[model samples]
Target: MRHATQLARISSILSATLPPELAGHVWFAGCDGPSAVILTDSPNWVVLIRFQQAQLLEALSHILEVPTCTQIIVRVVPEGLPNGYLTQR
Candidate 1:
């Protein structure tokens, strides 16, 4: 429950931080220790997000009031599928 809440908060922050064109395409999936897990609807968005990884981490750190995330794990998960499918596969 706490984890989900944190992810939700991060997602909200990410939505605001990302450009309008990329906003709805990216989301905070979860966290892996000091790393942030991200999911995107397309591989194209993954590439774009990676280009902004450093800035995104900094924003997340400042917004969440936590230590800077050490890494980001971005995955492509097609839209309309249940998010849990990522773990299942």
Candidate 2:
């Protein structure tokens, strides 16, 4: 439905919005209300991006015109796991 489209759009936007240094290391996990969740390949990226969250939110808000995101939640995948695969954490 409408929410599904919104989520997909968010994921696409995030793929392009992440910093080059962080690109390919993270992905859009999903959203809750206006909070956007991102999962990274490693804890290093998680810690790095968490400090840059304000800029990230700003980047996303610029690309997002509807179903606005109000927050960013960054998480790390389990060590030794592959990237971009969804799993219960």
Specify the highest-TM-score model's number.
1
lDDT of each: 0.74, 0.65
Tens-digit lDDT track of model 1 for 1-89: 56656666677777788888887776787668988888888888888888778878888888767864778899887655344333322
For model 2, residues 5-77, the per-residue Cα lDDT tens digits are 5655555566566667876566666666888787777787877777767776786777665647777788777
lDDT value, candidate 2, whole model = 0.65
lDDT of 1 at 62: 85
What shift in Å separates residue 73 of candidate 1 from its native position after superposition?
Answer: 0.8
What is candidate 2's CA lDDT for residue 55? 70
Can you give the TM-score per candidate against the true fold?
Answer: 0.75, 0.61
| Candidate 1, pairs of clashing residues | none
